[model samples]
Target chain A: MKIWCDRANNQRVAWHCRSHPETAESNAYAEVFQLQRSFIGTSPVHVPTVADIQVVTRRPADERPAVILLELPNRHLGCQTYPYDDLVQISRLCRAANIRLHLDGARLWEIQPFYNRPFADLARLFDSVYVSLYKGLRGTVGCVLASSDAAFMAEAALWQRRLGGWMVTSYPVLIDCERAFNLNIGTFERKWRKMCAVAAAIVQATKDFTTSDGRPIVYFTPEVPTCCQVHTHIRGVTRERLAAARDEVERDLGLSVFPWTLPSPFMHELDPDWVLVNGDPLAVQGMDQYFEWSITDKNVDIPDAVFAQGWRAIVTVLFA
Target chain B: MKIWCDRANNQRVAWHCRSHPETAESNAYAEVFQLQRSFIGTSPVHVPTVADIQVVTRRPADERPAVILLELPNRHLGCQTYPYDDLVQISRLCRAANIRLHLDGARLWEIQPFYNRPFADLARLFDSVYVSLYKGLRGTVGCVLASSDAAFMAEAALWQRRLGGWMVTSYPVLIDCERAFNLNIGTFERKWRKMCAVAAAIVQATKDFTTSDGRPIVYFTPEVPTCCQVHTHIRGVTRERLAAARDEVERDLGLSVFPWTLPSPFMHELDPDWVLVNGDPLAVQGMDQYFEWSITDKNVDIPDAVFAQGWRAIVTVLFA
Candidate 1:
């Protein structure tokens, strides 16, 4: 297949993806090792994404492939709704457009804890399931890519071998797979419950505080908002005043917290219309006390009533 | 894409590639799930090959898929001169008769130590290579199928997800994949070297001790054969005789063993060609002594060099 594309000079976003332009310049057919994504601009974190795949698949008129591959998120994202791999959504699109959809479910093992379901229950949903020996199962290392339709699986073996994946002695991986199959269900259930419980508790403890419009302060969201995130605001309430209030709350609640990394104070005029606190972790106990003061003690309350300007906590937790 | 033929359900020996009535009933669309392959059969184990693929492809069967998939040996069988997946052979066969051949290397990692070559080097020989995190590498259960061609990869990913191999939060798999990639290579390498050395030592130890036709009271093989392999003959030897011999050998050598598992006096045929001495195993130190015995003892002087051979003994230095 003959193709042409531009080169990446520095750390810049490519036409379809972000990569070193020099890579594309050198090899017409090398993996464009994705370094960083364009989400939350200029943040240094690795997250290979569906959006990235979407961009590349729509690269050119001629280059559009017969199929587009993507990992299917569990039906729910931690019981909270967010940007999820909508199989139902995309499958219809693919069928209408005549483009095939593929799923990469390596962490299917870890996926189940979110649903209170079994791995097998979730796996049956996919066209083909490539299950690993070790990952969620903690097996030795190996995977079995299976499908309900025998024909497709029979043909896929060709690709498996072509990719240098065919191996001998699946015995070791069998060990891991078996362990995951037999042991993981319970472990995952317990851990998932714990993770959900902790997360829910944190949300509940902090939800009693909200923005002016009455949106819950500590809200649990299935979907991270698009381009809407939390940031620092230091206009109305001086850092010192906020710090003093923080100290008072901690003294009342008996909690310790770092000064930096705490949410910044806001002046009424400069306060955001919808002041949203993000998933970014903050002083948990202090947050708990801040809300405690907002709700319990009315007489000795401070002058900063914007926070107390008739607020109610909204706790949205993925798990109970 | 209508096609021709299916894999035969004929017993292992009778199932060499061919059109069969049995196949018509068992495999509808040339789809095959070869479960019985793990058995290598007896000594002269051979690779099953197809003949007409070359002649038919000469004219290019337009309706047929351009690709044919095949499975490879389990690594425990180890690599020999052919390195079955070696593209030179497949490509040569393809070029000679005009066809394309792909591999199903799902467990290719185990096959590596036997090849004793770098992974990338072996990968370069194939049109594509698939690696699993769960296989020997013990990554999250998934396969990373790579190809010399980017277009092929693009095509495969669609199948991958369609097959339900795609997963969100495969980050867990990546973490384990990194661990597998880093940890297994060395462990596999060391194990392979140790096994091969053990096999080689067995061969040399029995080289001078074997009868003209290469039968020994106790011998080894170049093939890093499986545990419990055997072939041998001794005068008047029965099951008990073999057991006695094993017990005597271990006692004299200060090693541990199960005499009952060995070939014995009454069990030996008058003319014996080969008998597995249960793939004799000893500690690292004992193995070194085994090598020394191979070098120092040119021909063990059979004390009762007659028809009714008696108890065997040797060396005056009390080496035990």
Candidate 2:
């Protein structure tokens, strides 16, 4: 029969669905734990929410799921960073239940600064670790899979070949990754701090978008974000105006304010009305519209004056 | 349960083993054809031989296998290319038997001339076609899976992601593929004619390496090669001496004559004794040593004079 390997990232996401009884025909044996949605931008799979991880893990051994997968910074539901203690608890529970735990650390590098731990330490919590080359690092294309089991890795190589993951030459990807690594070392940490402070300041300054009681007009999840990423729930605005604001920022200040509507394919598993605004609010509509914003290298260098001008344009478009 | 997709290539090769009645516990419902070994490289899976493709197809409909997979110009075997008539009968048989046929056209491009048909025509015979970007094209990583079934492609995408085949950015691989395509288009046809003519000339001139009966000291299959790929079995030379000849050709002539011994992972699925000598004789041991060579871009540009010198070195080391 013709067969192929499944993409590792998608595997991490879809594996969770195995536990849902509705999907039993395909994943009948799985004991799935539906965790509260964590951040995983627009990815079709819904990640378990961090709040539910402990409760799910506390299940009896026989009732425990066969595999537990976690994505650091949960880039989809909202850029939520779990505490080390919480991760430790989940890992311990998996161990007790004899379940395999895997990490989809596509943005692990982007979230590393908030954890205050080395990557190796975080990676040690799982049986296997997958790190992407191009996510936030802005490299070409590649991924690194790490595991303590040599046999598993050998099998992985066979699987990689089956999946057409074996490239005759990956020098170009390696070169680009190397270049990105050298240029980006220790940079995410700085960006993480700047993003949180700036997002909070932006929310505070936009008082007109808030309730009269001084409650903010916009709802920013993890209000102070865990890393460079932040999710925003826009209020007092229309989706078209938000989209217009995004265009205004780009046209007026040469900056992109990536805006998305609710129910994106990437976020279809989540609430459909949740719009994602990634790094700067451009344009969006509806009181329930959500978007995401994350500080990236491109905007990291924007002059303070230029950023302020862009912010003005965004606010003007939304309010005007 | 922890589940993963079987690596396609290896699965294609190895799945036949499941058809053996001894393996029926695992594949109780499968109507597997244990045909003779076809070219599957040294993949651990053993493919049915070309001789069995027809015999197996003529089986009762109830006994017909569910899937029939074929590789054009089988790379692991003697680079054999099936005639268009043979493929047509196989396709018609599969249709009659309600079996799904797929082609692993990894080297289909290399053997295009032997069939004298466009890729589309060859591909149309199967339910799906998988073409590698780097094989003879000498590009980077990536492959394209084509099919008339849109649903299958969509499903394949999910499997691709599960296997970590989804890359955030594959531009590096794409760019290299584009470059190779532009530079090498229509080049294979020209090289195919040159390789066959040169190989015949080389075999004719190396008469001294043969016995009085004219059966050469070395064996060449497709002695009239079906494509640019040729297999050789060299007797009468020490493996070390053959290796030295390879080094000398590369050092003195500034040309590489890539030589390899048996037991290479790439050839592991083949007989362990089948040593592959790509161009000229290089590293090999035993009078029964064997190797294979295929004309690729790396050696395609060698001047006729340089190649002649290299050829001389190869003969001298083996026969003198």
Candidate 3:
């Protein structure tokens, strides 16, 4: 993708991206190519608005971005995505402005249930689409990049050879990727439905819950997830405390609640003036522990009540 | 290796290499880095001499090479290696000249039998050593680069991350490599001995043989095997004819003689003034077909007489 980006914007023109600063696109542009990037702002729902994109496109000719990278269901921002009509408008705006639009469809499979649209319909809107086989598709590590532009893809192949990305044998990885895709692709819609039900149960069960410190204990970022993933925030709880509670619940009840948690990026965004200690704002305030709760076919079969009970057990240990 | 070369030779200092232009070092430096390279001439045995090393190191300060890359038992040149004494002198020469020496030990295992030296002892001569896990070890695919220079290895690791060389899970490859090394490392000396005996038998059986065109039918490049590999050149036979003969012999007698053949690089060197037709000299004179006959434990069990018989059948078919 870096190579393709380099080739697409050979003049080193600025790229427009709404993804987080930690994403592969942001890192590659800043660290590898040293290319300028213009970020589109997200609405309250955490999805980039058409107005936000026009703001960058309205800039002077010298400042106009050459390419706009859109991530389907932005993973870092609670896997939020624009409504289908809004996305279509954004795509049209880019085309009218002569800016190439690329899709970082790493989690494209997850959003299919929300849009209820065919993969081709979503992919056709972008000039280039990159999909990860390992993400929602449950494949081994690999990705496929599709582009209508033959020259761009040819340059990508040249770069692949130059960078030693072409392996002598990738048959094993490809075979595993195919097997995983076949096994899990059909289960995503069901998984997404289960995830929403599970989130609703947790929100209902912990409606008025509060920490020992008198702070709201738990809440969902979007209140309703668009995909099989949702970000759950635990106010007045340190990441360490959350992890301990999760481990305790799993050990005692044999129910795993969350794989891991970290200090939420939104905490700093919501409170820009928050004090920091030792380079960590979370050190001064404990109301920011968050984790992305992702439901796969493996756990979708478990009733939503079981998940609510597991979260309740975790919170009990947290406020103990 | 490309990244390490870029980091080490930051000023784009010229490199010294004796390996063929098709080898990784030559291609990376020429095509990737666009760095200047100085070639050290090989002796009749196709091993770079200490005199060749001095010629490059003796250059004026402005033209002195930064690094000298030496391939163990140059795979393209009949798997020939320098006498242990010559290699020691070349290593000392590079050190005295303040030039870093790197070993392209892709075939390092093949040369161990000829040098009769410990792997560590041979590796310690150069500033950095690279060995392929797949070539002779029969592993899947991977290589290890070792160096006492902490900074160089640290830089290599950084490049590995930047280039996406680090896999999500390489445990399977590592496990297979370890298994292959354990199974094959001890049998190299025996394989080398078997390869020499087989080569001698082939030479003896076909010494006076001639093609229908009155040209010599076959000959070994070095006239003796240095390691488990030897380059066998078939005079008066095009690569196409050689391949057909090999396939026919395999089908009829159930004996696989040569896996594949190509016009030997040495042929062009031997007859630089040969007339060319359609960009290939072999089209004008079919006297250059050759292939590297690499002996592994799989073939070492087959008697030398069987191999000699196989070659004889191939040649008879080629003449007919």
lDDT tens digits, residues B16-131, model 3? 23364344422544544455665566442355678878887788755666777788878877887778898889899888877778888988988898888799889999988989
lDDT of 2 by residue, B118-179 (tens): 87889999887877777677777667788887877776665545434454456667888889
List interface RMSDs for the candidates, in order. 13.2, 9.9, 4.2
Q: State which docking tier applies to candidate 2.
A: incorrect
List of clashing residue pairs for candidate 3: A236-A287
Model 1 backbone overlap count = 79
Kindly give the stretch of ten consecutive residues in candidate 3 chain B with the minimal lDDT sum: B269-278
Q: Report the CA-based lDDT of candidate 2 relative to the real structure.
A: 0.59
| Position B63, candidate 2: lDDT | 57
Error of 3 at A60 (Å): 4.7
**Fraction of the true interface contacts (Cα pairs closer than 8 Å across chains) found in each model:** 0.00, 0.19, 0.11
- Once fitted onto the true fold, the runs of candidate 1 whose alpha carbons sit more than 4 angstroms away are A1-320, B1-44, B48-66, B69-78, B81-86, B95-100, B104-121, B132-143, B154-180, B183-197, B207-320
Instruction: Give the per-residue lDDT digits (tens) of candidate 1, residues B54-78.
Output: 3333444443334444334322222
Instruction: Determine the C-alpha RMSD for candidate 1 after optimal superposition of all C-alphas.
Output: 18.3
Stronger candidate by lDDT (2 vs 3) = 3
For every candidate, the chain B TM-score is 0.47, 0.73, 0.86
The DockQ-derived docking category for candidate 1 is incorrect
